[model samples]
Target: MISKSTIDKVFESARLEEVIGDFVQLKKSGSNFKGLSPFTDERTPSFMVSPVKQIWKDFSSGKGGNVVAFLMEHEHFTYPEAIRYLAKKYNIEIEETEQNEEQKQQANDRESMYLVSDFAQKYFEDILWNSEKGKAIGLSYFKERGFTDDTIRKFGLGYSLDEWEAFTKEALDKGYSLDFLGRTGLSIIKENKQFDRFKGRVMFPIQSMSGRVLGFGGRILVNDKKAAKYLNSPESDIYHKSKVLYGIYHAKQSIAKEDNCYLVEGYTDVIQFHQRGIENVVASSGTALTPEQIRLINRLTKNITVLFDGDAAGLRASLRGIDLILEQGMNVKVCTFPEGEDPDSFAKKNAYEDLVLYLQENAKDFIQFKASLLVEEAQNDPIKKAETIRDIVQSISKIPDRIQREVYVQECSRIMDISEEVLFNTLAQLGKKNVAEANKKFKKERKAFEVVKKEQAVEKIDVQYQLERKIIEILLLYGNRTEEFEDLLLKENEEGELVLEPELHKARVFEKLYLDLQQDEIELSNENFRTVYYGLISKLNEDDSFVIESYINGLDSELSKEVTSILMEEEKYDLSDWEGKDIYVKDKAESVAQLVGETILNLRCFLIDKRVSDLRQRTLEKKDGNNHEILEEIMNYHQLKKLLSTKLNRVL
Candidate 1:
């Protein structure tokens, strides 16, 4: 466990803008930095980082939190892991508190797996460099593949010993648990005997985008016909092959800066491309491309040029991935090497300038690539040609952007000598079929909701939710500021009629909000928001000098996230350039009292409306008799509603 002092130092040292700017391209927007959301595919900037607040908000995805919270969300880090990452980034030494056995065992399972993977990675590298057999065989193989020592170290390439129990014994001697080793697939247990899983293979450490080791991919060096040439770590808690791309940790910055990614087939291809000055490249690592992999690339760039081996089978295999990329709203281009070459060989064979020039000259957009590849197989056969045309249309239909789809459809028409009308008709049929299927699914889902509604009355949650959230936001932002409040009380006048009379009082914002809600017997309907509200109230009552940062750090991650989101929601987009144009806007602090009172009134009005709705339902259901009291109550509620609306400057 990291001591509290170290966590505080990390929080103080790690600047929000500096940390987030590493992953996102941010521009100055008033007092905050704004950028497109890394969590979502967005054209406009909705992600804002506030250095003053030490938090960030992604309006597009509704994720907001502190720097630690961002790492937890973005990198899937546990709290300690996030803290450690920040501590490392800021060059703060971690101070650890001694843990009891129970505390030690309480470590997150996924974090334990990560620790084991990290240890195994370093262990393999040590062996590859220091062990005699590893140096002679594993290191030699990487060299033979033309990987320079610098490239080898850059990629964290390593080697496992040919002896089965070498790594297992070392790990056990280092006080690491066999369970974790087994869980990470570093050590296999057969009949209760442990041995290394990657024995006799050169190792490639697969990393997450943030450069944490998730697992390993090892290649067997010997020329054994029966043995599999390559073996990968099994899917454990940390590694999902469909979601991880080889060399992404090294390639991401280049991919983002260049605004393009070169997709290749294997690890060597990625390495070779990087060696040849094409740093924006990653490999599917010999697996078929998946939608998850495409979405991963889509985060960095919208354009992907898939480099294929010139073999016919390789081209056929890559055809399906183009449509998948289009479906994700990304641009796909195809580049093929000479007939006898693959990316690894071709990259090694050509100089950097020639390779780049060849790619620039030969890269074809998806429609042209698809048509050219299929035309040879469809020659002299009308049926095959018709099928090929439909295939092209199907790929075009997968594109979500209308302009791109239209351009691709036109290209397909021109290249295949087919009429635009026929291709458009085919696309229309496909779209209609998709919509019909969607409608059937919607109806099925609606039936389930109808049954649920019949079982219990469904509240109008949307408006109430918005009003409740508005109140929470008010409290979170300016809850401690003092303000003048008017207290209303009912009094009988000389005319024998009751009227509301006001008296002035001064109170802190938190005090006023608490009393108003208590008088109305109201609680937030959302459980998470309610918990945070109570926590805020407790802090306001207890502390004389309450700091928002301290309060946020004290809460659990989930509640802290909710509080940050509420505080940051209004900063979703950059404010219009009113100041630049010599226009003035009022600061929120100037009208804090009014904002708080209005939010409280809106919440009360929403509750009263729900009460009136319930009363009307009862009046209707009991129409036979004895419903006069309910109707009278409804009339009184309407009068109350009118007064509330009057306070809000609305005519009812």
Candidate 2:
């Protein structure tokens, strides 16, 4: 367990915007920062971070909380793990008690696999540095590849011994589970025998965006014709190759800072670029480009520059994946090295400035690149040229932005020497074909959805629930504020009608709200709101100065989520720039007393209405036709409602 002092120190030192900005590109919006939702696929910014409050809210997904909550939700870090991450990031020292054996054994399966993967990485790194065989083979290979000691260690480059049982035996003897070992594919188990899966290979640890070791990718050193050269950890609960990008853990911040990502095809390509001072680079790890992988980079930036080797054949095949990037509405540019070189070799040969200059000079938009590459093959062949033009138009059609699609179409027209009209016509044809295909697919699922929609009932608005929620919101925002209020008192007018007369009083918002609710014996109908309300009131009663961050951190996860949601619900409107449209928004702070008074009055009125409803129901259910007492009770409730409504400035 982490000590409270250390956790508090971390919370104090850590900035919510800075932490989340590493994962999502945040742009300034008035007093806060706004960005595309990391938790959802969104084109516009809906994720908000309030530095003043030290909390964040994703309006798209309805997930909101402080920094720790964001880490837990985004990275799936355990509470302790999230604290440690923040502690490490902010250079705060952590004082934590070591977990006992039972505690370690009780870890969940996914966490256990992560532990085993982490252990394997450290063990491999130790071998790479200290073991004789590791230094002689794996270290020598990395050194020959022009990787410095710092670069090697930064990427956690390591080696697995050649012997079959070397890793397996060591892992089992160290109290790590063999079940996790086999599950992570670190060790292969068949029937009753087990052996190292990456024997005689160098290790490259694959990490998530949060820098947790998800799995490993090992490259075999010794030449065996029957054996494959590269092996990746099998799909486990913790690691999915298609969703994981190599070097993302290290490159995320740089990608967001630079507003561009350099995508390559292999692990070495990524590492080499990083070594060459190009930090915003990641590799597909030799897998086909996936939508999940694209989204990982999309969260950070909208621009992607794909680096390709000089091989013409490979470049042709790789062009297919660029379409996927366009489909995501990302601005993609392609750069190729000299005829004999790939990104790894090119970066190794050139100085940092030269490499960067080369990329800047050589990078071409996908349309230009595709047209130039395909135009060569279509030379003197009319049919092939026509097909090439259609192909380029199809790629253009994949772009989601209408304006960007038109821009690319014009570029294609210039490059292929065709009129924009012809290209636009082709684009329209392709769009119709795509929609037709999509409709066909949607038709299959439409019947099932219609059935589900028909079975679903309309949701009703709960008045008491809304009023109770308003009370909680007021307490959270202005509970500590002392304001002047107009206390409404019931008085009989000359005509014998009950009238509300105002009396001025001064009190703290929380004190006023609490007394009003207590006097009326009103309890929040919603369980979550009631729990949070009582807890919040208790905290306010204890201290005149309330630190919302500390209070929220002290609550359990569910209540914490509830409080943050309420606090941030109003912030979404702030992002709309409403004031710029000549529509002024009233600051709730200016009328805290009225806000508190109205909420309480509304709650009282709702309760009285609910009581009247119940009394009427009782009268109807009485089979003996004896409802005189119930009718009188209902009339009294109605009189109370009329009085409350008068106070609320509403005609009943």
lDDT of each: 0.86, 0.91
TM-score of each candidate? 0.82, 0.97
**lDDT at residue 261 of model 2 (Cα atoms):** 97
Over the stretch 495-577, how does candidate 2's per-residue lDDT look in tens digits?
A: 99777889999998889988888887877789999998898899999998898888888889999998899888888996787
User: Model 2 clash tally?
Assistant: 0
Q: After superposition, how far is residue 593 of candidate 1 from its true place, in Å?
A: 2.5
Could you give candidate 1's per-residue lDDT for residues 239-311 as a string of tens digits?
9999899999899889878889999988999999999899999998888899878877876778999999988
What lDDT is obtained when candidate 1 is compared to the true structure?
0.86
Please give the range of 10 consecutive residues that has the lowest summed lDDT in model 2: 311-320
In terms of lDDT, the poorest run of 10 residues in model 1 is: 570-579
Clashing pairs in 2: none
